[model samples]
Target: MMKGLVSFFFLLAGCHQAAGAVNTKTILLFPEATSTNYVSLKPTEKVLHQITVCLRSYTDLTREHSLFSLATPNKDNAFLIYFSPPNNISISINNEDIFIKVDPDVYYWKKTCVTWDSTNGLLQLWINNKRYPRRVTKTRSPIGPQMSVVLGQEQDSYGGGFDINQSFLGEMCDVNMWDSVLPETSVRVILTDQFSLTGNIYNWNDENFQVHGPILVLKDQYI
Candidate 1:
């Protein structure tokens, strides 16, 4: 019994240590109306096998815009989150695009969250904590590194494609991303603006990105 207890304690300690190694960072972006306003990020993890984003969009125009994107240096491989007016939201993984319709209200702020897991190719989207149906794709491989991550403009090529027609013109806050799947409880925390659990790959409190153009900052409650 004594030996078993000692082994159990050791296992617990190991688990704690492993959890401590994850990166937790987040950021906020208030995109300008032009294509020049954007933010860029790169993760040390070569393959973004899984990812999640929690944010609110404040654009009221019925135009196409990009919320988030990640692509290789050569632009050959990529994943993207795009929004089109009249309640359309799309996700692109390795060039395969999947879309879902959302609420059409553009004036009111909306709590939005998206998650993608490459392991099983499960993709999920949540609005105001209410989850939509899940979609699956890109199960064969993971997103490679040396990626150009951007917020606001869609990457037509790898990292340098911007079209004014597809630029984001809105306030985005409480932006968070994780390299793994988040639990139900964590999702709730994010939606309520009481987030204590930090993202393993990107914590908003920590600076992990660069801002370009005229992105602004606003209160977290605006979302």
Candidate 2:
């Protein structure tokens, strides 16, 4: 009986080694291109008229991969940030995918941000603080509640059906999201690391997310 209990405790600890939240200076390292590794962000339940997501990642993947994925019950690609090597990045809102052609150098410690507003239906993507041409979509629909936000894999279902080919394989950090569209000045400050403006909706911290599988949360300076 004693041996069994000890083994069970060890198993629990190993399964939950990095299961809690992550900090601002922390980076999540998805060591392989498997669909099982991911981070699930938990934010308060609320309808969103606007949203802004920003994060930095270091990777050398040449194929298409998912950087951020948010899904509703009905729409798996409700808010997805997917990238195809060289110059293509796509932002899908309410199942609509829009592409933005950017400079070819999009890997290795890249900073990315995307914003959308329902009031004006304006969408923008920023790479290293460089804003691209704005577009519009889903002009009047505010995103409903019940969101399943996942990092490292694209969801083909509400919270399941992950594809290995679309899984993010790299080190990701500074993942944050806001309920409002951030201004240019605020974005510039974030890109420059002038201030640590955490997102009201979701931000990288020690209490906002859950890690799964064999992922590592390491301090940023080491990498």
Candidate 3:
């Protein structure tokens, strides 16, 4: 009996640490919108001169919502993925907002990928295998370490200061982040299959991430 109790405690300890790749047929479901309900994603990598973030999300919210929030030190919006209403998707890199007007068909569940290169400040957004026109931002700063990545709530500060108004109310899964920007062909292949590529920085299969508030990890059938 004591042996089983010890194993149980070890399993509980695993729940709050680094996450492995359990996100395969699994989805991180944020069933409600609240300031406290969110998941904190830890990127194993530190410095990033370029970045590629890809994730699949399903939501019916018409108002503006935050899909991905990455905060570091004084730069609260160091790198963020935000959506407004029907088709306005904005990616904020180092507090500079670059908007991308996507097709209306992307309003539902879809796969989205965004890549940014600090060399020339080039940014590209791809949705459902189709790449939109790329844009150039003026911020070529390198994102340092100490990144606080959150899923549900947008962080006004480094790790705290969450507002319920911009909270995400839906399901998100297959979130992968690479320290280097992936090629266009690679992004196209990833849009077809979620398992085609895995993120070196933030692998979705890593099962050791922390869950705050009330979030559900359910199979695709439940979604």
Candidate 4:
């Protein structure tokens, strides 16, 4: 009986390890990506929006153009990408490359980062929450129809066209989408560590397990 109790405790410990603590405060909650619960942001807001999606690499279609679809952080526009990996791990939006690289020293093993400039509508690259000093572009474009967001598969294309050997293969957590450009301090606070922001947050996990729905909603005033 004593041995059985010890074994049970060990099992519990393992379970806890497997189910790591997800930073719920930063987790964005959408209506399962199947409902009309998203908004759109276009030329008015231009290139500002929020986003949170999980990525995985385990399909046979070997291209990088049909794996994910995005809402315009508002309900006015949408974009889809069919991505296949191992060549250039980046997603292109408005002809700009928003890439992901793994840093050996950061918390996330591989972080998909792209910096958005609120002042002039530009982007920069940062792998694993580390910001690059230079801004990449300064073009502003209209985004999409804010509707159902898709993960693991693109909405229009069945299989992304590419090499068929590359795909996103991992779990995405703490997915968040913000409409305005977050300050450097704010990004560091949420990305580097775990904390809550006052008003600009769009989606957040109500619990660690993602069982609760997104409870916060605001107008497009964060920008």
Find the candidate with the highest TM-score and give its number.
2
* Cα lDDT tens digits for candidate 1, 1-223: 9999999999888757544432222325554567567788765556787778776666776778888877776543267878877878888877778898877655766778888888888988888777878998855477776677787788877777677888887666545678877877888777765434556666655666788876765433422
Q: Mind sharing the TM-score for model 3?
A: 0.85
lDDT for position 37 in model 1: 71
Highest-scoring model, lDDT: 2
- Tell me the whole-model lDDT of each prediction, alpha carbons only: 0.71, 0.86, 0.84, 0.38
lDDT of 4 by residue, 50-102 (tens): 32222212232224433344544333114444333333345445445455442
Clashing pairs counted in every model: 9, 1, 11, 34
Taking all chains together, each candidate's TM-score versus the true structure is 0.78, 0.86, 0.85, 0.46
What TM-score quantifies how close candidate 1 is to the native fold?
0.78
User: Which lDDT tens digits does candidate 3 get at residues 5-30?
Assistant: 99999986665332322333578889
- Least well predicted 10-residue stretch by lDDT in candidate 2: 15-24
TM-score of 4: 0.46
* Ranking, TM-score, top scorer first: 2, 3, 1, 4
lDDT of model 4, residue 50: 36
